[model samples]
Target: MSEATETEKPASSSNTTLTNAQKARIERNRAKAENLRQAKLVTHPYKIGPNGGPEGNSVIKVQGTKYIDSGGGFLLEQPVLPAPGQKSNAEAETPVVIDDGINIPVKYEECLDCGDQFADSYLFNNFGHSVCDKCRDTEDRHSLITRTEAKAEYLLKDCDFDKREPPLRYISRKNPHNVRWGEMKLYLHLQVLKRAMDVWGSEEELMRQHESREDKREVGKARKYNKQMKQLRMEVRSSVYTKKTTELHVHEFGPETYNEEEDNYTHACVSCPYTETFEKM
Candidate 1:
């Protein structure tokens, strides 16, 4: 043979046998390790998607030369999809972790809120929790990007939310007895938009460090508050999704509490384009 690679590693010449107790101990240790691995809170460095160039673009030579001469197979077209009831070989088989000598360890991760186990690669940008992709979709989310921040904040603080608007109209096709179902839906949607302010307020407080304190006994209280607020924000996307329509009844600011200087807000989404429609009304 020209050379034996890792995939072709030879088996040990000596035969070995383990006692039942030893085998049981190994199984126990594996279970314990798997549990601990799933409980990790922070993201690991190695568990990342392909970010750079050549390594990420895994280009296999489809058509190459013999020695240095000709070409190969697989290229020029998009991959063919499998038939309805069929699956790719990779999906059909059960997972098997193999130690091909070089060693690629199996990985597991868990969401903090839902405690669901998933590959770390499926992790999404969670609002305030160590959540998975599924939880991230439902949890309240606060997007702090350059594009969304201004609009979200305006809808949060300056909007005159408490000002009730004209009721929305919709039809119920299911049953005549459920004719008012459309009205109930409108109320539900209104509540969802109102919650956007709640999410926005929590985020603002965390950023403003309003919860921060300098007392001898409360030096770290602010940080703890910040964490609580951050976690609370993770539910924002879910709140927004519950009622998708945008309207002026959605309030982000008022005089009763949170911030004292926000007196200009009259409980509605004003100054914001969302309130422009209500300006004439």
Candidate 2:
């Protein structure tokens, strides 16, 4: 009787177990999750060969690094080609014809007055006018006409109208004793009358004085000279008529009348009664 001690029963040897259908379902779910992950992988740029194959099968080699896609296996390469009746990209971009007008060199000439380079058609001679045709036409119309007319009128009005005279005759008068009494007297007394020409301060002043007494003085002197000349001409005509000779006639003798032969008189003085006296003297 071992003091009636309690003894533990031996543990039962039972193992936990699952059905076969449950294990197959778990394997199928794991395969589906792996396929989804492979679809999400991105494709990168790659080179290809002529036979429509990637440079290195399904694996991309970038800087010696290999990237593999487990799902698609490999990607094919397609070469880009031009469409029918279409030019190639390089040929289409090239220009066919160049602009020949731009390449031609232009010719020019120097202007005579301004010494500036201008086209051949632009060259012109001004002659008396100072400005060009375009400038003259565009500017005042009276400019060209006024200057030309002024010069012409001035020349016409200022022309010398006085004539030359003949040489002086040194004739001596006979006295009672058969000796020469009077000194030699020149036949012609043509004088350039130096009448006081009005000296105005300016052109405007002269124009203002043209209607004054100074202008009248000039006119009076001209009239007196003309009257005296007419009287002398009448005297010569009277003498010629009285002589009843066609060759010999009367001439001016020191503001007086003198008889001279026609053969001695080569030409007549315009202002005086002498015949070519001033010119010969």
Best by TM-score: 2
* Worst-scoring 10-residue span by lDDT in model 2: 187-196
Model 2, CA-based lDDT = 0.42
lDDT of 2 by residue, 1-281 (tens): 44333222222222234458877888899998898876674544355555534443455555655555433565333333467688877888998886666566765555444555654331133222233333333233312222223323222121221222221122233444446554322111111111011123345554555456568888999989967876777676666547755645555344323335421224454546555421111
Q: Candidate 1, after superposition: displacement of residue 117 in Å?
A: 2.1
**Model 2 regions lying over 4 Å from their true place:** 1-20, 39-93, 98-105, 114-116, 119-281
Query: What's model 2's TM-score?
Result: 0.22
Q: What is the lDDT of residue 104 in candidate 2?
A: 65
Tell me the deviation in Å of residue 18 in model 2: 6.7
